[model samples]
Target: MSGCVFCRIVAGSVPSFQVVGEPSGVAFLDSRPVFRGHVLVVPRPHLETLTDLPEADLAGYFGLVRRVAAAVESGLDAGGTFVAMNNRVSQSVPHLHTHVVPRTKGDGLRGFFWPRTRYDDDGQAATYAARIGAAVAPPTRG
Candidate 1:
């Protein structure tokens, strides 16, 4: 973690366009942005990927992500936002970071979600969503 660039940024060893900094993590503007006013939210502790981050820290990490997303939408007057986090694949940096990019109408990002596929039917889509919802539901104590 010592040599990681994101850790350096968090340590104040490197300059960054910081937006939000908390005990859990820091949200800063991406140096190489897909669009202007793009922000990257990174955990303070050096977690290489989503699976690497402890479950206890997920809430804090995602809290910053939500805040930064809202800021990107309101501050940039964007129509929407494209929030994403690439793991090992296509991940420029080794540290885990979420990209919250502001989106406008007709930005020509139609192909961003390449290889798009649709559900076989509405029922299939609903079933998938419901399965995911159930998977995330809090465990009930016996």
Candidate 2:
């Protein structure tokens, strides 16, 4: 956590373009943006992945993410937005963060695409969705 760039930015050790910090988390403009008005939301407490986050922090983290997304949309007048958090396989940095990217009509990004085997049919797609959805749904107690 000490050597993490995001932690350094949150600690004010590194200069950032724009930053919004709350008691729970921090949001800042991405240095290497995929699109204009790109922001990264990170929790003040260091975490390596989504699973590493406590369930109680989930709401606060995502709430900040939504607020930052709204700011990006209004400030940039973007047509749309993309929110993403890469886990172990796709993780670029060993820190928990969410990317909020502003999308415009002419922007070439057509969803975060990666080469993959084609789906055989709608049934396969549905089955895959079901499995992922089951895992993604919040716990009833939480």
Candidate 3:
């Protein structure tokens, strides 16, 4: 946890293009995005993979993921979204982060071979973050 970058991001030590932060998890724009509005949702505490997440926390964590997926589609005016998680293989951060990528028709995203991209500048990343942040629904009171 001390050296994990995602933990630092959740702790607000690292500056990130944050979209949403909840009791369940925090969502932010991926610096190396597969698409313009690509977002990564990670648990507040350090968890290396999906299986590492506690069962009691699943609903809260995934509930946030669900909202972000929808927000990515609506905020970016995309047709749909691609939601995925990697355990160990290709798990860039070793944190239990879910990727919610905006998708549209004829986008040419062939398969697992994701073509990565970046924002022209920090302002562009912030703009995308704001859009998704605005579109994310408030957490339900239960």
For every candidate, C-alpha RMSD to the true structure in Å: 13.5, 13.8, 0.7
Report model 1's TM-score to 2 decimal places: 0.77
* lDDT value for model 3: 0.95
lDDT of 2 at 141: 36
Error of 1 at 90 (Å): 0.7
Q: Which pairs, if any, clash in model 1?
A: none
Task: Order the candidates by TM-score, highest first.
Answer: 3, 1, 2
How many steric overlaps are in each model, in order? 0, 0, 0
**TM-score of structure candidate 3:** 0.98
Can you write out model 2's per-residue Cα lDDT over 1-142, one digit (the tens) per residue? Answer: 7888888988889876544677668776666567545677889887999999999888878877877776666655677788999987787777899988777787777667622233355454344323322322222332
Give the better candidate number (1 or 2) by TM-score. 1
Shift in Å, residue 2, candidate 2: 1.4
lDDT of 1 at 25: 82
**For residues 1-142, what per-residue lDDT tens digits would candidate 1 score against the true structure?**
7889999999999976677677768877666667666678899999899999999987877876876777677665779999998999989899999988778898766756522234455454444333322322222233
Instruction: Write candidate 3's Cα lDDT for 35-133 as tens digits.
Output: 999999999999998888999999999999999998998899999999999999999899999999999999989889899998999999999999999
**Whose lDDT is higher: candidate 1's or candidate 2's?**
1
Instruction: Please give each candidate's TM-score.
Output: 0.77, 0.75, 0.98
Tell how far residue 88 is off in model 3, in angstroms: 0.6
**Residue 22 of model 3, lDDT score:** 91
The TM-score measured for candidate 2 stands at: 0.75
Q: Each prediction's Cα lDDT score?
A: 0.72, 0.69, 0.95
